[model samples]
Target chain A: MPNSETMAGTSAAHSEAMIGLYDVHKSFGPLEVLKGISFEVPRGGVVALIGPSGSGKSTILRCVNLLETPNAGTIKVGAQTLAFSKRHRLPGDRRLADFRARTGMVFQSFNLFPHKSVIENVMAGPLIVKRMARDEARAIAERLLARVGLAEKAEAAPARLSGGQRQRVAIARAMAMEPDVMLFDEPTSALDPELVAEVLAVIRGLADDNMTMLLATHEMAFARDVADRVVFMRDGVVVEDGPARQVIETPQHPATQAFLAHFHRR
Target chain B: MSGVSYHWDFSFLWGYRTVLLTGLAYTMAYTVGTILLGLVIGLVAGLMRMSRNPFIRGPAFAYIEIFRCTPLLVQIVWFYYAFPILIGIEMSATTAAVLVLSLYTGSFYAEIFRGGILSLELGQWDAARAVGMRQGQLMRHIILPQAVRRMMPPFINQSVIQLKNTSLVSTIAVTDLLYQGMLITAATYRPLEVYTLIAAIYFVVLFPLTALGQYVENRLRYAE
Candidate 1:
């Protein structure tokens, strides 16, 4: 048997999958949302999950962050791994929190805290969750807000900004945590057509910086442009997975072909 | 055809001003005290009602319902008489009055708070949790700030109502505004003048607060 030191060294060395989901299963009452789904996102890789509405695309992203607990699976992010079964008990609140702190999630509604000024919203997670010092967090927040092109709007309230600006602030807020992996669940789906471009630009910037990301999005063009790999899912299962060019362009599976055809027609 | 009248004397009010003002001070103390205590109770009870644990949620739900359903006067009088017997600790009439009144006001405030919290979109909760905020941090930093803003107008309105409810404490001999006014009326045999003055004082205090509540409600009416 390998010693504890060797095991730790092995996991540290070979943990290329920054985020992984193995046979994740989820159900709400009688309806199964995710059925034995599996995926792995390597370090600094960009994976876009594209699928129809009920295909459990968002559920997979949420499960990676443990927002939704799966009935059966093993989720690995960096060195932290959680194994789930029918009666799986969560390890501890502290461990789960530490796991979550290493992964950042962006939502569809761009949920910037309405009561906070834009800069404070960006600084909140680091200051509150990570317990960072105020000046350091504020400096990081200022730089991030600048990176997202909202430096001038730091003191403004969320109500004063456009939907795209709010989403960008949300991205900056998530980036403040400096996570090992980022999850985007329909980030641009709620924005106006013109506004979507601004938000997508910031996301593309993250990809340029080699941020490991998992995006569940409808923007096929943006997905193709930014993603290293693309996974096509339908009815709680992955229908196709390959290079972004082949999956979006060639689409060998009939389901993939149909899904892409619908997108093309639109 | 004769309206019962002794010629009304506005002159006596000047002499009685200190008495009336002293009573006003007591009323103010009671009002502020009840508001602080009531708000603390309402916040705890409101959060307890939201708890998933049956043990906590059930008691919180029952407390809100019981106090809200009973009359404030009855609750106060019951506490004044029964509390010493039940708890084996005699409380002053003023103490009993304040305790019962704060509790009564708290039930309504709890409902107001609960409604404010529920009114927020579930998305806010999700977004906060997604960012690695623990449940306590999320409620404190995200949910409560927004909910408290929404709870403000109603909370102020409840304060006004509780101020008026303090009039009930006169029955327990607390010598509040109403009680002092009653004493002056008996001493001078001028009921209309003294009672009218008392009514006007209540109006003076409460009208501004009600108006402030309206202003806050208007300001908070944002596109949620």
Candidate 2:
């Protein structure tokens, strides 16, 4: 039998061609944040990326949405080839915005539009960017809020909500766009310890439905429970990639082992 | 001699009522006109200051800085005298008052607009951009509403001050509430009574506007 790690990596990568990054390099001034990173996020599957702070995991996720343009190499999301240095187009290119409309990103800070009520926040992307009708946007926002268990708080401003509720509302807002891919950047990290599970539960439900997801999370149980594969990063490089079972159970890289040991001990 | 039949002379208010009323009308007109014009200019200048290009932001910065550093009275006098000299527009004194008032308020409004935009969290911009909102769309849908909502109180305060500032127009021979009060009191020699009556009229006008400001603030309190 093939090694479980290799099989897991290959199986996870080959599941679908939803997103691919080829030798992506990103630098801010003199500091290189991402050094030739490569990965494939399969459609309708969940992949959890874990690393220390500043390991470039979030930067990679941002590049997928063209939020941060990689200095070198290319990123392909769905059928769109995102901006790269070779193309000489910044991430704010028209196509990048179009591509962003097709992808939903849940921020760590839950930056819900403060001026809008919860349902209005959810409806904003659909109505403003997509030019959808108001009544239709309202209905769709209601449905997404229901999915996230926040239907009751629809008319309330995000400030009236708890951190967890606001994060769920943020997720619903992103989902209301009916995006093809959803990127979660430490969705639960901003919540209180008790609140984290509720947000994670909503994400776990998304995983069960086979929603295309690329999650950057710190919760080990979340990785083991929901992610199809777990990619470990250290020092701006992917140190290990394998099925969640093996990666969590038996990491091969000395760096992964040391990282996990330091992490879990705390 | 001590009893000089001193009573609150209520007749000056009615006798000079038309003049005071006309002055109040001029004050209201100038206040509203300046507020609207200033808000529009401030919005544009504030956005230019926040823009990426140094060419754009630099001039906007200079505009805001120069106006904010200079006194409103100086600006008003300059607009009234120097601007007309520069442009060769022979306008009336009252017209000059309105024009100068708008430019003065425009400077303060620019500061208010810039401060409101800067107060927002940095993450909000990132999220707005991530959602594919163009700069214009983001301002319309996300940024401006929040900024305008946050800015209501200060704007209202400016209006109250603006109403009081209209008294300064008397310096340039434009008859306003204070000037009208002065003309009547000087002629009639009822300084205490006339001034007291003037204070009462100011109360009547400004109290309602301050109340409106408080109401709007209370209504939008949930924005926090």
Candidate 3:
């Protein structure tokens, strides 16, 4: 029952797990993406899911937000719990929406609403979903824009921004919701090489603020530096899960070692 | 072939100016009314076409396909001539024309709406949902704002065709512009000048609309 106020100043040692997935299984037609995946992100924790492509890292992040429904297992975020199986049905849209509202997600593509100005995109969830007053929403949006270093670009359309700038706006948009947990599905993967650091810096700032996050990223060094824990997956199962430095630097599993080898090659 | 020219005189039709103007008014009225009604139908049917329920999707599919595949003239005639007989109510030619034309235009507009919505990348939906917006709110605020921009060119294209399709009302004995031209031709016996004037009037009205569509397309293109 940890709240954001209590969670904010705490470190990853906080006893409560903010997000929990137990034996989560998801399949897309014939291709099974998540096979009995289980994990937890403790309150004020930053856990990074690192693996090569098709290792279900993105799928795991998506499932936690209910973006991709799991075929079998339980997902608990905040106070809401959803169990999916043959006998158990996915929650109704309203409940699922309520569940998702507690968690914010940022996509690889930086899907900013193209028609809206930067501020409007950030304000949309509050203004439209929460039915917050316009002035209040604008205040929150402006603060978030400033936080992401995009305050001056607030009036510009999303189509007009650079890739890094757009991703920053996306992070701001997600933050405006003030969700208990944040999900980043390859946030920097779509950015230019020069732009990746700026986006990652914003994420690093969030980690410093003690925001609970589960990110699936290819940025190995950032994960090792910013994330409190790392879960290494390959072929839809966790191969290694431990402290960020140990899992990335020293590996007990040969599979994990071989995977890290590719990134280590000079 | 001999180069023979008949006398061109529009003086006789000057007396029928009021009638032609009234006819033009009817044409404009039907176009405006039907386009508005058609848009409502289009929005509803278009969303329904995307529904997951078979019951909802099936009927929308039938309505769009049945109207779109048939000729407008045939639909106008059937509604005026055949529909009333089946319904056991005597419908006025005006009522039948409006109803038939709106439904006809709606089918095309539905496809345009659907295509415009689908044309957006899947990331748009994903992003909106990530923000916790419901289906209706997402479509209204996020999806539609972007989709409407993509839909503008095709929407205008369909609406232009809708203005021309209003001409089909003449077959149902509605006094739209073309029907007035027939009356003028019958009275003045100058089919050549009368029909020419009618074609010129239609051209004058529709040319600007197509130009506006092109302008909008360009603006949207540059906007991206």
> How many clashes does the backbone of model 2 have?
0
Q: Top model by TM-score, which number?
A: 3
The per-residue C-alpha lDDT of model 2 at residue A203 equals 89
Q: Model 2: what is its DockQ?
A: 0.44
Candidate ranking (lDDT, best to worst): 3, 1, 2
TM-score for each of the candidates: 0.93, 0.87, 0.95
**Best prediction by DockQ:** 3
Better of 1 and 2 by TM-score: 1
Off by over 4 Å in 1: A1-14, A91-93, B2-6, B222-224
TM-score for candidate 1, residues paired by index: 0.93
Q: Give me candidate 3's TM-score against the actual structure.
A: 0.95
lDDT of 1 by residue, B1-224 (tens): 24565577778878888889988998999999998999999989999999988999999999999999999999988999988899999899988998898899989999999999999998888778777888888889899989989889889988999999999999999988999999898889889889989999999999999999998888877545
Deviation (Å) of B38 in candidate 1:
0.6
Candidate 1 Cα RMSD (Å) = 4.6
Best by lDDT: 3
Give Cα distance to truth, residue A231, candidate 2, Å.
1.9
